[model samples]
Target: MIKHRFSAFLLSALLLSTGVMAAQPDNVIRPVRGTIDSVKGNAVTITTRQGEKLEVALTNNTKVNSVSEAKISDIKPDSFIGTAAVQQADGSLKALEVHVFDPSLRGSGEGFNPFESADGNVNTMTNGTVGKLVNSHGRTMTVKVKDQQKTVIVPDDVPVVLIAPGSRNLLQPGTKVVLHGAKDDKGQWVVRGISAGKDGLTPPM
Candidate 1:
């Protein structure tokens, strides 16, 4: 009985040590999505779509980028796009941000999963092509990937942006922004990089 107890204790201690070792800081990136409430110098206050307010400090090294405007006509059949959207009660997808991906990145990270949308809810991400498009009453797009398809509603207000270079001056009040931040050892949320959209678009990635 004594030997058995000692062996069990040793096993528990080894497991605990391994867990602590596994938790080493590996440059993890946490996503921050919300609307720009205000900006004072290097500090930015954002009211998340969920109503939670977060303040992030921008350093001189923070990478900033923005999504330019695109028209509904820009979205064509077979054009690859990834939309962060919320499903409506009527079973239709309402787009928050529609990202037009270049042909080089086609079929990348293609699936539906819970996404942290700027509007605060468990949204869905559909990455594929415009298998079908209707624009008479309102715009609707069907995204097809492999054997699956997701129908997304694209309102005129939603911002569409192609991948391009951006600057920090784009971080203005009312601009939708998403950032990847990390908590420092002092428990401060340090923003590593920020991705902002022109007016209404949330960062697609």
Candidate 2:
């Protein structure tokens, strides 16, 4: 009986050391928005809009994309896009900004969720395909995400931009960036994708 108890205790210790008995960390991809403070080798330090500093690691497989200004005419039927909007008093969505995604990024973030803006305002982000366009009270359109649909109005003063493939050279200090990444086992932020502003344009989306 003594020998059997020793064997059971040894097995439990081995499992604990290998993390088999430990709770797994959350690996869900979350957005991090900040301005680059410095770039050294494979790591980038940033100061978040909330004034917290964080260091994010970049792997060779990390994707870097850039956003540039686009016109409202760029949006059409069948376009895949994402927009940040606020709910109006009448139950409609008024667009704060519109971002047209590259074809390769179709269906990215494909749903509605609450978005916290840099200035602390709460908005909604809708990513989907354009179903129809109507020039009613404004540039109103129907956006469909899977089976659900949302009606959004793009006002004349709202910023619209296009997101496309970019190079890592865009990750310069002092530039604004938004990245989606997950924490690794070592508690390091591993970037899956990052979007940087181009030509002094802030990535509004």
Best by TM-score: 2
| Model 2 misplacement above 4 A | 1-30
The digit string of per-residue lDDT tens for model 1 on 80-164 reads 8888888889877899878886676677557776675644455777788888898864579898867888889998877777744
Cα TM-score per model: 0.55, 0.79
Error of 1 at 157 (Å): 3.1
lDDT of 2 by residue, 168-205 (tens): 89999988998877668987778889999988777886
Query: lDDT of model 1 at residue 13?
Result: 72
Model 1, C-alpha of 39: deviation from truth (Å): 15
Backbone clash pairs in model 1 (N, Cα, C under 3 Å; residues 3+ apart or in different chains), count = 0
